[model samples]
Target: MPSALGEYFQDDDGSLPEIELRFAQPALLVAALEYLFGLPGAYDASRDTACVWNLIHDREEPYRSPQDARRVASGELAAFHRLLRAAQVDGCVLPDLGVFVSGEELILDYRMGPQWGESEIVALLRLLARLRKRGAQVAVPWWGESGERAFADAIAGIDAGRSAAN
Candidate 1:
């Protein structure tokens, strides 16, 4: 069988899994949420259906709005950095910090968790694909000066890993 065929068969669900995307910038976070919510009709079904949640005191509370995330992103990030810096923290993952976006069928969860399953990884790939297809510039941290090449390399790595498993 072809490698593509073998890889396809390995996936139980050929659908995009629920995803949580972490953004380095508040503007980027807001933009991603806007796209998922179909700000300019990027997703017809999800338009106007996105909600934001802020993680505080180990609990989630509704943010004023998705755009409101930008307002608090700086403060939250600074505090988070301080927390990580204090006490030689290792493996001390923070719960769903900052803003989380959810829509009709899409979830840009943005939670900091300890484990990542294959489903979550695939979901992230699918999410990036969807975003790129919609004309959004999905810039990841490792993109370096050559984003296209880096992204292509990353996808190839996933495919190679899958092929090895088979």
Candidate 2:
């Protein structure tokens, strides 16, 4: 089975925008790209639901700090390089290509599902936390009706948990 993103990307109509593939692990990069390009059973969406962890960094002032931006950019690049290397060892293929940045934000896009298991989800949450620490806003783009419901449920669960905790 092919992943949802992989199948979508392969469509001739080109519905999706040109996304820059970035990662903290090089191994994931290779696997993700390979799966996107159709490497014969490279990805399985039913078994692998993709997660997008977006990091949004906000600036209070109109003046941007060049030094801070440069540092962020450097960190992003380093993370991506490491991700690429990790993907190679894990038998994961890189997406056709990807973009790199540091200060802007670190977005982690991954496909997960039943097969990914709880451990994977925990890992993803950790990654989200890391991005959040860097001042990025994390979000998951819901697809169809089911996806929307799932996201809603997730939010509800979090809200309920927070209320109970308080």
The TM-scores, one per candidate, come to 0.31, 0.31
What Cα-based lDDT does every candidate model obtain? 0.36, 0.32
Q: Please write out the lDDT profile of model 2 over residues 35-136, one tens digit for every residue.
A: 332433233332233222223443222212222234344442122211211222124333322222334433334333333333333323333343334334
Candidate 2 Cα errors over 4 Å, as ranges: 1-103, 111-115, 142-166
Q: Poorest 10 consecutive residues of model 2 by lDDT?
A: 80-89
Per-residue accuracy of model 1 over 68-127 as CA lDDT, tens digit each: 545456443111100011111122222221223322112332322323333434434444
Residue 124 shift from truth in candidate 1, angstroms? 0.6
Clashes of 1: 1
